[model samples]
Target: MKQAADPAKERYALMEKIQMVDFALVELTLYLDTHPQDTQAIQQFNQLAVESRDLKSAYEQRFGPLRQYGASFSGYPWNWGDSPWPWQL
Candidate 1:
């Protein structure tokens, strides 16, 4: 039988992916600022934005909110205080 995946490892991997995508989106934004007519870069930026949203949603669903101050939803009992805060990773 296959072994179950480690939640910590999975969370790290997903966070890394989201970070990379977000970084790329930022670079694309800067590029687009200078090259506003670049349709290809615009498309890429839009695609990555959607991917980032989806990845963050998945992470929050499994691992808890990635932000506070009304930026992310919290379930009952206010789970933001749960252990293993983002910096602990």
Candidate 2:
């Protein structure tokens, strides 16, 4: 049977995925800047952008919108609305 997810745990997992996508985007960007003819790097950048959008969509679906200006997400309203609190772990 599938288990219910813990909100804190789920949020942390999403954060990790977002971090990975962030890194990939940066890496691809840097690579493309130096190697503009690298078709593989361009392909990878396209893939990373799609993946990042998916991750962000998932995050916004579960929690509030994290971005400052998203289509469907209102800005975080609560003071402590971002992520795992320092003591949550």
The candidate maximizing TM-score is 1
What's the TM-score of each model vs. the native? 0.91, 0.77
Cα displacement (angstroms), candidate 1, residue 49, comes to 0.3
Model 1: residues with Cα > 4 Å off, grouped in runs: none
- For 1-89, candidate 1 gives per-residue lDDT tens digits of 99999998999999889889999999999999999999999999999999999998999999998878998899887999887776666
**What range of 10 consecutive residues in model 1 has the weakest lDDT sum?**
80-89
- The C-alpha local distance difference test score for the whole of candidate 2 amounts to 0.76
Clashing pairs in 1: none
Distance from true location, Cα of 60 in model 2, Å: 0.4
Worst 10 residues of 2 by lDDT: 78-87
Candidates' lDDT values, in order?
0.91, 0.76
Candidate 2 local Cα displacement, residue 28, angstroms: 1.1
Tens digits of lDDT, candidate 2, 3-72: 9989878888887888889898998898899999999889889998999889878876777665653354
Give candidate 2 misplaced runs (Cα > 4 Å).
70-72, 75-89
Score residue 35 of candidate 1 by CA lDDT: 100
